[model samples]
Target: MMKAKQRIIILLLAGLLVLTAASCSSQKAADPATETLKLGVLSLEDILPMVVANEKGYFAEEGLTVELIPFQSTVESQSAIQSGDIDGMMNDMVVAALLKESGTDLKVTSVTLEATDERRRFAIVVSPDSDIKTVADLKGRELGISFNSIIEYTTDEMLVAAGVSPEEVNKTAIPKIPVRLEMLINNNIEAANLPDPLITFAEFNGCKTIIDDRGRSIS
Candidate 1:
């Protein structure tokens, strides 16, 4: 098995082939500007390889131009791709399925982050004053999540993996990460599903982590 960093580098280079494939479409002139690949991305660890490649002139050396467009959310990222404002964007399997279901032609070029014992990507957390001390305690309470998103999937996965059946769970569509975090911290929502940084912050703020996807890669 390749190390995590090595796998990321290889996958990122592999992803550039998508740009090359698109470069052949409807172009009459050799315009360097038009040939530039536009990739819509969120500010995540996955963007690191693209940043390094751009900064070190790797794309230019390889006769390719790349533009990395930052997006605030997946909704915006998908909107950019669908409107042709961007050629591609970093996305997950859940979003890919949703895109296909919506009739969008999508291709998954690479896997940026993989599951590892040291990496805790997401968690189901409860409010500081919440009576929910475990995933089983979440049966009748609301779990905040962004609707039809990875967060929602993570919540469901966390529940099922922890032996809580779908009929025993309750989900509330909070739709925004910041809002979800705030609601969970302030006791507005009994529990909320979130990724790291926010998950660590919630722990620091006295919110309890009922479970997290660390070893079990359910998401």
Candidate 2:
């Protein structure tokens, strides 16, 4: 079995390969008449650059027409890409891998964000009143996550890093981040992994953080 860090690196490299190949293929097949490219985005701070570029008419300045398509979650964005509704989206390396494995012609051309000790972006959290204070306490408990996506991948890795086997925890698919956050706040699940903005929001509202991707990088 691959070590946790190795697995993360391999997955990211695979994403880069898929992304580079897709970009080349698309460029070769591009039509000058249709200059518009539709890209999917979520309501996360990580997508702020694209938003600013669009709002500031950067694409227009380059004689390019770019459409910023908004989706409620990564799962929705992936569906849009798979169905040809959108050409691509800003997503995690893990999501890129999952898309490719499911036969979606996609690529990850950039690393917009990286988790670090000084800039933690994702975390495993619990209700403020829950007694699950440590990673080991998560054993045999159900973790709310969007299954098969980046959230699940990070949660597993963080658990392993904390000396807890991933097999010891159960993952429940709660597709929407808002719904997952709500459930977590209501104590409907023992724990949940969330990304920033929501992670910050949850902490402010009294959720206790168990562990985070501090000092870690997905790529």
Candidate 3:
């Protein structure tokens, strides 16, 4: 019985050794330098260059088969990276900064957009007949903005520029641009801040732009 037990122990040790060797071999075979790199990306139209680079075989030329995974939001993409479901992602500075702040070992290898572009402006609009004429008038009024978005940042900047502190305004998070536009039109909210497509659409449908980067900033 002792001999049989010794033999079983030897077999288990041998199996562990074999498994270790197989794992080493598998890792060597799964070299990122030669294997596909999975990239998680947010569903933004600005990622056209990355899409083009992959479709045009630019990554393949560098011995990389980039598997592009599109997520609906940056938060979703960041979660993918944190969970090791993806190798890397194309994210904004603020998003990456937030990840770093939360103790995630994420790094930014490139800058996708200008650090400060004059064209990157977020528009603040009010209903044509709304009493609010300027950012100053937004005090105590409900302003709709998309949370964790560029529009939110620009809106804050606009408010600060107009001497209206965040404490003076009641900013609400409404994620959908269409919903924000509809609210602005139906006079449900005092004003809404969003990107050009919605801003243009709203202005076209009777919402007036109260604060826009006429010539100062990029959108």
Model 1, 1-219: lDDT tens digits are 236545545758653322111333545656674587788876555677788777777667667898988775667777777777887787666777787788777666666565468887788999999988889998878888776777777778878888998567778877656777888888888898877778888899989999998887765
Per-residue error for 134 in candidate 3, Å, reads 2.6
Q: After superposing candidate 3, which stretches have Cα over 4 Å from the reference?
A: 1-35, 115-118, 125-132, 146-151, 175-190, 195-208, 212-219
Q: Which ten residues in a row have the lowest lDDT in candidate 1?
A: 15-24
lDDT of 3 by residue, 1-219 (tens): 556444443432332111011122334456556676777765444455566666766666556777888765556776777777777776555666666777767555554433234453357899866988888888999999866756567777788777889779899987655677788898888798856556777788788887775454432
Cα lDDT of candidate 1 equals 0.74
Q: Which candidate number has the best TM-score?
A: 2
Model 2 C-alpha lDDT per residue in residues 135-164, reported as the tens digit of each score: 999998888988777788888889989999
**Ranking of predictions according to TM-score:** 2, 1, 3
Each candidate: what lDDT?
0.74, 0.75, 0.65
Which residue pairs does candidate 3 place in steric collision?
118-217, 118-218, 119-217, 119-218, 119-219, 120-218, 120-219, 121-218, 121-219
Quote the lDDT for 80 in model 2.
74
